[model samples]
Target: MKVMGFAGWSGSGKTTLVEQVISVLTARGYAVSLVKHAHHSFDIDHAGKDSWRHRQAGCREVMVSSGQRWSLTRELRGAPEATLDELLDKLGPCDVVLVEGFKRAEIPKIEVHRAVVTEPLLFPEDGRIVAVATDTEVSTTLPTLDINDPEAVADFVVGYLAL
Candidate 1:
């Protein structure tokens, strides 16, 4: 599957843009998947839930299944964090995968930016950035996409990857 990433600082609207782009792509009948990197510890199961209880009881991995859907939660248990490639391998076949972080990963990416964030742009130091999606004007040789226009961003992604 083709892969693209969106990288930016906190409050740069990366999440919002990614969500909107997903909607556009899916509406066009593309099977899209996303892998987001969280900087902090996170939990998908809540206490008192069966899955949470299984995890609390020291299960190495707990999978909850139902008619609608299912999810598997694995406990690293001090194991090293999984790399981006490893995580990508676990996903099923899809037309595209939009990664939400892993800024340093050597994959094509769109650097989402917002002028109000006051942070320096990442494209200068990252060669994998093929474009920039921003709310305000910016200086760069790469293609600049209107952050508010998800359709345009979706078009860029499809055209860039020739999906």
Candidate 2:
């Protein structure tokens, strides 16, 4: 499956832009999946939930399912964090996989940027950042996309991927 990523600093609205692109891509009949890298610990299950209870009881993996949908939560315990390629391997296959982080990964990516953020632009230092999506104007030789315009961004990605 083709893979792309949205790399940016905190508060740069990477998540929001990814969401929009997902909507646009899916609407166009593409089977898209996303893998987001969180810098901090996160929780998908809450207290009193069966999945949470199973996890609390030390289950290695807790899969909760119903007629509507299901989720499989695996506890890494003390295992080393999986690499980006390893995570991608677990996704089976699809038209595209929108990765929301892993800025250093050697995959093509769109750098979501907000000039207001203090961090410098990533494309300069990261060769994988082949495109830039931003709200304000920025000068760059690479293709520039409208971070606020999902359709335009989607169009660029689709065209780039020739999908």
Candidate 3:
């Protein structure tokens, strides 16, 4: 599957841009999937739900399935965190995969930048970054795009991946 990534500092609007891109890409008939990296603890299961109870009861992995959809939740149980490649392998087949975070991974990425964040650019230090989406002007050799224009950015990604 073709994979692309969005990387930026916290509060840089990476998630917003990615959401917009997904909408546009899906409307254009491409099957797309997303993988996001969370820095803190997160839970998709609620405390009283059956799946949650199963997990709390010491199940290493819990899979909840229905006719329309299914979800799988697994506890690492002291194992090392799974790598990007390992996570990607779990995703269903799609025309493209849009990843958020994983800035260190060896994949083509668009650096989302906001001036208020005042963070350093990732493209300068990371060769995997193929483009930049910024709210303000950025000086770089790579292609620079307006962060608000999700369509253009999505186009760039689709073209880059040749989807």
Candidate 4:
């Protein structure tokens, strides 16, 4: 499977662009999977839920299944977080994997930038950044894409990966 990433500071519209790109790619008949890296502690299970209770009871992992969908949640239990490669190995087969973070990863990535954010651009230091998607013009030799146009971004990804 092919892999690509979107890296940006918070509120830079990375998630929104990724979400729209997923819709575009899937609509084009490609199976797409995503791996999002959360900087803070987060939980998919809610308090008092059966699955949550299972985790609270020290279960290493819990699987929740329903007619519509199923999910497996594993507690790291203080172990180091898994790396991008390890997480990729856990995903089912897909045409492409759209990663939401892991900015330092060496994989090909698109730097999402918003002029309003005070944070400096990442492409300057990140050799992995293949292009930039921004709401405003920026000074860069890399290909600049309109952040609001996910279709264009999707096209760029397809061409870049030759998928």
Q: Model-by-model lDDT, in order?
A: 0.96, 0.92, 0.94, 0.96
lDDT for model 3: 0.94
| lDDT string, candidate 4, 14-62, tens digits | 9999999999999999999999999998999899999999999999999
Backbone clash tally (model 2): 0
Tell me the deviation in Å of residue 27 in model 3: 0.3
- Which residue pairs collide, candidate 2? none
Q: Relative to the unseen true structure, what is the C-alpha lDDT of residue 90 in candidate 3, on a scale of 0 to 100?
A: 97
lDDT (Cα, tens digit) per residue for candidate 3, span 76-141:
879989999999999999999999999899999999999999778888899999999998989998
RMSD of each: 0.7, 1.0, 0.8, 0.6
Task: Report the lDDT tens digits of candidate 2 across residue range 56-163.
Answer: 999999988899988888899999999998899888679999999899988999999998988989999998888999988878999999899999999988988888
Tell me the lDDT of candidate 1. Answer: 0.96
Q: For this target, which candidate reaches the highest lDDT against the unseen true structure?
A: 4
Q: Candidate 1 lDDT, tens digit per residue, 4-111?
A: 999999999999999999999999999999999999989999989989999999999999899999898999999999999999999999999999999998899999
In order of appearance, the predictions have TM-scores of: 0.98, 0.96, 0.97, 0.98
Q: List the residue pairs that clash in candidate 4.
A: none
The Cα RMSD in angstroms, rounded to one decimal, for candidate 3 relative to the true structure is 0.8
